[model samples]
Target chain A: MTSLPKHPPAKRLGLAIDLDTCVGCHACATNCKEWNTGGISAPLTDVNAYQAEQRGVWFNRVYTYEVGGEGPDARTVHFPKNCLHCEQPACVTVCPTGASYKRSEDGIVLVDHDKCIGCKLCSWACPYGNREYDEHVGVMKKCTLCVDKIYNQNLPEVDRVPACVAACPAKARHFGDFADPNSTVSKLTRDRGGYDLAPETGYLPTSKYLPPRPGKRSEAMPAAAPAPAIAGAGRFLKWVDRVLTR
Target chain B: MHPAYSVIFFTTASGAGYGLLVLAAIFAISGLMPATAWLGFVTNGLALGLIAGGLLSSTFHLGHPERAWRALTQWRSSWLSREGVLAVATFVPAGLFAIGWVFLGTTTGFFGWMGAAAAVLAVATVISTSMIYASLITIRQWNNGIVPVAYLVLGLMSGAVLLEAVTRLFGVHGSHVDVVAIVLIVVGWLVKLAYWHSADTGLVKTTLATATGLGRFGSVRLLEQPHTEENFLMQEMGFVVARKHARRLRAIAQATLFVVPLAATIASLFVAPMVAMVLALVAVVSLAVGLLTERWLFFAEAKHDCMVYYGR
Candidate 1:
């Protein structure tokens, strides 16, 4: 049962994250925790909640990186990471129990907690470190892409999306079927040159990350010359000048 | 790569057990070993005991040890599952062989074939165990051709040393056994040396640039971590051992696992039967300590692909 689906899924539901727009506010991560703790994979337990060494299971995480060298060309890029729902997920195949599985219908990888033995092999198999082991529950958990809410008919249609996508303040996270060429995610991927992370690993991740676009600051503004030093300026005047110049 | 003690014990003990089973089968089939009921009980009991104890110890690290049986269901794709199934299946033939040899005092007819079957299954079980680590592409040190070969050679080497010790207890002299043990020890060390060399010099292609898909922007450096505190991923995969300490441990492993054991085994050959027994036992003890250190290093030195994300 841990074997991969024999046939490709009809739809690949995935996310397209825009590094250009992500603010690294952790809104998506928090929103995901907020929903998933009660949505499907509930009780995302945190160990030592009030202590100095607090840790817990989370489906999404945002990282901040300084790209390029320390120069004018250098830029800070906020990266949000999660499971790619890979086409060739080793995590699923490595499970001794048929707990970790990929859906042949929608290409979404999920963990069935009931069947999981919590041997932690799947965690070792994941290159992206997306799978989280809940010590309290003694099972593996990961990003479900908000499976429960995405297809729910109870809420308004506009609210029917992944909790992370719905909560992103910058509108940086887009979700749709990647298998469809005309879908929003696919179009965004094509137009913005979205790319996979560590493609050499050959997991064939479904989710894509849009590269940060060139900033307009370099093109629009030239370096300004330093203002002339005020000769023998009063202390009060020097403070005002310093504030104005800054 | 945490070097969990349970796993180290499991692999080492079970590997030696299987090796002993294979060697015992071969000796029995060739009429090299005595066909006494006492010898049969001692050899088979010791081998099966080690195998069962190691298998049981492996379950201690699992979060849900009670549900461990479910692991047998996925042998079609999982090496761990295959190992579980094979480990259990081996007991059938091995048990029958033990019963026939110990009670019936005959190993040449039906029981001999059962012993042969058990030997094959035992080797397969060890290979499956090695594949559990070798098949993992995430850890460069484990995903090597040398991993499986080193495992098999070391298992057999340890088993040979133990066999020498046990045979010496009965005042049985087999010069060829000592020669095989010496050769296997030398060959095992050679394989281990190659494994270490490859691990030390191997280049990891995935860097921070490739990990974050930001190579075009130039060098990428982590400015901030995703969480304020260390998470499970960091605690588990981000484990880093000091270079200085690793080098020291490697030296200790080489001395205890190889040099001391080899010296003891060679020294045992020319001594009196009683002295030989003591020396062979010393070799076994040294080898066990050495193997534990080596196994610890195996996990400690491994660098996981996910560590690149944590700036490790």
Candidate 2:
């Protein structure tokens, strides 16, 4: 069952994240934790909560980085990373048990707690580090893309997207069937040139990240001329005096 | 990458175990070894005991050891599953061969064919074990040709040393086994050194820019980490060893595993039979300690691709 499906699924459910607009607010990560803590992979336990060193399992995380250098070209980019639901998810295929598997129906990678022996091999096989082992449950856990909520018949279709996508304050996260070229997520990817995290690894990740926009160049400021000797001497003497005092 | 002790023991012990079984099969099939009861008891018992012990130890690291049997179900796609299946399958012919040679005093006909089959399975098991790491595309250091070569050669070298020690236990004075052990040790460590060299010079295919999809925006460096403290991924994959310490460990591994073992095997040739047995025993003990350190370093030095996100 861990083997890839013979035919690709008709619906490759995935996300399109706009890296340019992400502010690294961590709202999506928090929302994801809040929802998943009570869902399938429940109680993503934190061992040392409110302590100096806390460790836990989280499905989504936001990382902030400084790009380029100082000047107008310098900019901060926030990347919200999660499971990409790769078409060739090594995490699924490398599983010793059939617990970690990709759904043939929707192409969402998931772990069945019932069958998992918690060998942690799937995590090692994954290039993206999306899967985290839940020590409390003694099983591997990962981003389900809100499978419980998304597929719930009782929930309204509009409210059926992933918790992270719904909670993104900047609306940076988009959820739709990427298998359909006409879907909004697919169009967004096509328009913004959304790319995979590590294409060289050949995972063929379904989740795409829109690259940060180019920075604007600012005019360099002019240097100030040195002051005259007597006044400058007084200023220099004061600076020296301050330095000596410190 | 965490270098869990159980797994280190598992791979090392099982590898040597299978290696010895393969050699035993070859010796029996080639009519090199006489079907003696003591030899059968010592060799078969040690080999199967190591294999069983290693496999059991592997389960200790798993969260749900009770469900470990389920791992064999997905051999179609998983190397771990394939290894499990092959490991179990190997015991069948190996067990039959042991019964025939040790209890019934037979090494021909059914026993000979069974020994041959067991040898093939033993080699296949080692290959399956090596592929478990080699097939992984995430850890650049492990996903290489040298990893499997190192595993295979080291296993054989250790097994050869063990065979020499066993031969010395009796009054046998076969210089060929000692020479074979010495040759295997030299070959094994050379491959290991090559593996280290490759890891040192290899270019990591992915970087922060590519991982984040922000290369066009220019160079990217982490400004803020996702968490204040370590997470599961960080705990499992963020293990790092100091360069100086790694160098020291490598030296120790080389000395005890290769140099000392090879020297002892050679010295055993000139000494009395009693002294030679003692020298062979020393070689086995030293090799175990050295391989333990080497296996630990193997895990410690590996860098996971995911660490790029954390600026590691």
Candidate 3:
């Protein structure tokens, strides 16, 4: 029952993250927690929220990496990571029960909570460290790609995207069908040379990341306008003025 | 990779069970041992008890122990499912063989074939158990020919040692069984050493750069972690052991599992029957401790591929 499909899905729905513009604010991660706690995979457990080591299950997480050497090439890249919804996800195939499976229609991998025994083999099988165990619920939890919100009829058409996609202030995350060449995510990947997170592992993930643009310096500090030169008494007055103003 | 005690005990104890079953059946079938009722009862009881205890202990590690039966449903794709199915199937023939030989006193003719069938099933179950770890591509140390080979060989070797002890207890001493145990022990040690060599020599094909797909930019380092506190992934896969400590454990394993047992087994042939039985029993205890330590290291030393993202 955990065997993979013989052929890839006709419409591979996924996300394309633009690393060039991610500001590392963690809005997506926060937004994911906000939405999913009340959404399809509800009440993401927190073992001890008020105590030390307050760990909670999150579908989205952000990491910062120093990609290049020091000096001009040095830059901190903000990486937002989640399930890639792989075409050949080991997590699905490694499940001992039929609980873990992939949808043939849209290629989203999911766990059937009723059937899950929570053996944790799927967590070991994933090289990306996406799936995590919910100790309180005694089952595995993962990113459902906001499947409920995306297809819901209660919400407005424009607000139907994933919470992470909706909350990204920099417009770094794009959600669309990747199978169609004309789709927005497909075009973004094609145009920006988006690549998989761990291509060497060869899971053939549907999600792609647009690598940070080289040496553009979007975060460069703007030069401050020169302050008027002040005499000894005037400088003292200016200092007092700034201090008293605050 | 955290070396959970439940799993450690399960693999080692169950392996010994299956191994003992294989050799006991073989000895009965080949007419090497007499079809004594007490011998059959004691040996089969010990084997079945170990297998059942080990299997039961494994369930405590699962989050939903009541739903553990559902694990057997996905045998077509899951090695764990196949192991569960095979482990249960092995019990049928092994139970039959035990019943026929111990109760009916039929060790030759039709029951001998049943004994043989039980032996084959035991071997298949052990192999299936080995494949549960060996098939995982994420753990490079386990995804090799050596893992399965080591499991099969060690299972047989441990079983052979137990078989020798049981035979000695029943006043049945034979140099042939000792010789077989010696060869299996030596082969097990050699395979283990070879496995260690392979793992030590850059078995990892993925690196931090390759795993992150940022090698073209230059050397990548983790400036900050995704979480300030430890998460599930870190707890499960972030187990690390110092090389110095690991080396010491390896030496301990070699001496107790192979060297001590080998020497005791060899000395048993020259010693008096009373002393020989004591030596054989010593070998069993030492080998059990040794296998436990080895299994612990097996989990402790494995580096999950996902750790690359954390700059491991």
How much is the lDDT of residue A244 in candidate 3? 64
Docking class for model 3 is medium
Which candidate, 2 or 3, would have the higher DockQ against the true structure? 3
User: What are the candidates' individual DockQ scores?
Assistant: 0.80, 0.67, 0.76
In candidate 2, stretches whose alpha carbon ends up further than 4 angstroms from where it belongs are A217-246, B242-244
Relative to the true structure, how large is the alpha-carbon lDDT of every model?
A: 0.91, 0.88, 0.88
Candidate 2 or 1, higher lDDT:
1
**What is the DockQ score, from 0 to 1, of model 3?**
0.76
> Chain B TM-score, candidate 1?
0.98
TM-score of chain A of 1: 0.89
Compose the digit string of candidate 1's lDDT tens values, residues A1-246.
789999999999999999999999999999999999997799899999999999999999998999988877888899999999999999999999999999999999999998898899999999999998999999999999899998999989999899999999999999999999999999999999999999988999999999999765466578888888899999899889989998
Model 2 over residues B1-312: C-alpha lDDT tens digits?
788999999999988898888887777667777788888888888889889999999999898999999999999999999999999999999999999889998877999899999889888888888899889889998899998889988888888988989888966546667777888998998999999999898888988888887777778899999988888998899987534498899999999989999999999889888999999999999989988999888888888899999998
Ranking by lDDT: 1, 2, 3
Q: Whose DockQ is higher: candidate 1's or candidate 2's?
A: 1
Among residues 3 or more apart in sequence or in different chains, the pairs in candidate 2 whose N, CA or C atoms overlap within 3 Å are none
